[model samples]
Target: KKLDAKVKLWHHNSQGLFDYSTKDFQEYTLKWRGDAFLTKSNNRIQNQPSLPKTPIAKLKANDLALYPGHLFASLCQDLWLVARSFTNGYRLAPGDIVRLGAQAFKVKQICTDKPTNKGFSLTDLLVFQEPSGETSQVHSLPCRVCLSESYSSQNPLISPCNCKGSMKYIHLKCLQQSIKSRVHSTDYSLAFMFKNLSCELCSKQYSSKFYLNGELKDLLEIKNLPQPYVVLESLSCKEQGLYIASFCTKSILSLGRSHQSEVLIKDPSVSRNHAKLVYKGQGIYLKDNKSKYGTTILVKRPISLKENPHLEFQSENSTIQFKASGLVNLLPSCLRQPVAKGPKSPSLPLFPVNKGICLSTDDLDFLVREAQGELLNTSLSFCQDSIQNFEA
Candidate 1:
């Protein structure tokens, strides 16, 4: 083909080494070999000739627009430009967080005025910067109780209650300390001690964060139906021995001096039918039979713990065999180890030397106090001297 006019082939340096200050065209011969571009130049185009030999397309710097932190759709306002960029390999989708300079913005939504080729639309993207600064994000939220950053050193904040926003974030340690303070307070309610901790806002019990560990979870979950059992200690009966009685389901146990009673109390002080230990479901109830000396549930408080934190046993008649139902919630981590239920023989001992349900110091304290009064502040720390003094 013969040339019609003077042709000026301009190929920009792909490596960006040689700087071109002006559009002043230099003399160069352009040739085509089966759609491959052949540009003959020296000291101008340093790399390979990537430009197409065909004159049907041309590359112009003005054809490209670079906009940061701004929507490309709004800047161009033309569906063709947006579609052109999409064909040129630029991904713009909803919920994708794009970065511009030091700020981050998330794409909220995408809408288009009209459909384009192949069911694709030139989208009008909507993006909003995510919450930043020293208060809005999680890094800025501080523990209200400790007055320090909650996640500075990997200390997680728990929002178990109804508190919202910044007030909701609180360190687990701080929350535990606050609960301990309330437990030790003079006006602390004993009823609330067994129940869940109430939130300061709604005054309703917290759904989560009820227990730091699985103590509460284990107490609430009753695995197998427990066989009712009772241990009697410190009774002024004739023998003054630790007695264990495993009764049948829904059966009534009679505690009296008469031999007809299931549990024989050979003492003159005890009436013919002193008290009845009624077993129903998973609970054991004590009903006084209107005797002269009323029935009282005796519980021995755990004052001093042994060298091992898990092993605790105090000698003498101070120990009380609390019924399984009332004492399950007062377990001091001993019940954490699953215990297998033995046979349903009434002759079986409740807590024998070899196979016995060992009670912790905290379990004993709570059991004793709960039996003595209706309302008593409960503490899991039975080893502490502040709780009570033992006979030594």
Candidate 2:
């Protein structure tokens, strides 16, 4: 009967089980006639029927409550469970529940390899504690930039960089205003006075994006920018953040490591004039400038051979060239009488010729082998003809 009750309860509240909160659990468990303060124990009760253990037995009740609905659901599914088993008797595993008075608590192991609140910073530790749903004195703290404690949903205080104490929290608008003041914007480009998007004191790059109260928010906001602008992001570890450069249809923007280049890349591998972006008509095209380390485009879909007749790509140490020519008509043009010349001939039976295909060193070697075989056949034929004539 207990087993049946448990099965029925699980079936009814399967959806809610994923995003189960303390309030929800308390409310739902009120209807249950079975043991209210139950633990996910592997050892069966002496007389009671068997009950299936909760899949999310590893998560502490407090930590589970702090999780967002999606994260809670993922935890219930055990998506991040490692395959290794905990052999140490001292170490508590998933499904091990402890009873304290009327309430039961589950044990969860959290990695403490990263130190908290050291000489470096306390922002991360404070941020972690902020989601506890408790009213804390931290809310009274003023913004470092504006020196105002007032904050609303429209313009909230955020700890974006690695700064501790009074220098930690700052209003989003104040930070944006500070960034805007340093930014040098012209008709063609927008350049930052600072090398990267980082805090002056901490020397840490500000997070590009962060979530607050389950809502996604951007750290930096650039407003009222010119149209037909291109934003380039550096993949290099040394340089970071988005660099914006605008261009007219007639003008070309040069990209390289040099200071003179319009879009500057501060990497050693990049040449002085690595590449150029040309805006023609409605389309933009990227062309290589014969750099030592050549430019590359990641091809996601099949490209039309007719539109792109010649294509060159670099693979490791070697450069590969692909060329496509007009289809070769195997039947002679004279053999087929010309029907009215419009643009294309339908009667020509066009076939792709090997000459138009991508040729490599292997293809040249195959041609050489064919020539040697033909010479050997010619020599054998000449010898047979001489023998026949001598016999005659």
Candidate 3:
């Protein structure tokens, strides 16, 4: 076979890794946030079943909305940030913190660009770096996806990207760090507007951050025709930049950071025995991990999670229900302890949990006040003491 000088075989996906041949090059798809993409002129719409519009009251900072892929896309953005690196090889999981440059930025989107014969590309990545480097051509999709997968260990000298092999490449996160402090340094648009729109299905509300984007605009907004059973959206922006990660009828992104966990829904009837949830960044996977079927998870509205840190997770049918907000943002980390490879970090006192522990909420509150500015987990010790004392 002849090769074009302009053609270069660059990236490969390791998903079906055991075969080694799984590295075949193909175009990855990255959709925009508000605009899901549609390639077929005959069919370009997204359809989701209705969800309850009622927002849950009194949700804790960590309480989450349970839904399929909802967690990985939103709450677990950080986790996806960590895991995204595995798109190459290294697998990541919850509770792992990636250390890199001294700054942080939001993951604006993940996308796969239009394909080329030489090889396919994933493009248009977003992040806010400190000092303030932000976006770069090298920082686009596939590159950023890989960089966000691993944690930053103090062991320097080795570059943060950690990628190796013949198809050697760059780290999008590193590229982001390199572009510090430029005016409007971010490649993502500074503006966002999600205040007024209802999910095409239940008309459920979602936050602005979790805005939907897909190519099937007509079918989604047709107002009368039977919408397609499945609608897909990618991470796109107002200017029409789409990232490669895919979202569908059962999937939606969650909105901010908090104590909630991302929710997942799976119907065996829809697919075969295989069902899994992946956070592209932090690399946490919650599927049939180590639990039996029918496990239940409860989450409140407006749940938030740090960009995906690995955490324990399980899901079932309607048993995994969440409010409208669940789909918009990844919820926060749990109030209770989480499993991690690192040393045990402290936990904060969950005022709501005090009652069961025999500690008064007010009393726990007072202790927390005293511990202000201390390590996050240190304050939790005070509450534990109060409980141990009361129980005695």
lDDT of each: 0.30, 0.36, 0.22
> On a 0 to 1 TM-score scale, where does candidate 1 land against the true structure?
0.21
lDDT per residue, candidate 1, 1-392, as tens digits? Answer: 11111233234432211112235434433322111211223422111224322111111111111111112111211000111111111222222222111112232322221222222111111111222222212566777777687463324565655687667777765665665443211110010122224566655454331333223221111112123344333222222222333453335666667766766555555678766655543334445565543332111111111111122111111111101111223445564322212111111111111101121112434433432321232223432232243312
From the highest lDDT down, the ranking of the candidates is 2, 1, 3
TM-scores for the candidates: 0.21, 0.35, 0.15
- Number of the top lDDT candidate: 2
For model 2, name the residue pairs that clash. Answer: none
Total clashing pairs in model 3: 96
Ranking by TM-score: 2, 1, 3
> Which ten residues in a row are the worst by lDDT in model 3?
1-10
lDDT of 3 by residue, 29-130 (tens): 221211111111111111112211221111122332112222212222011122121223222111112111111112222222222222212211222111
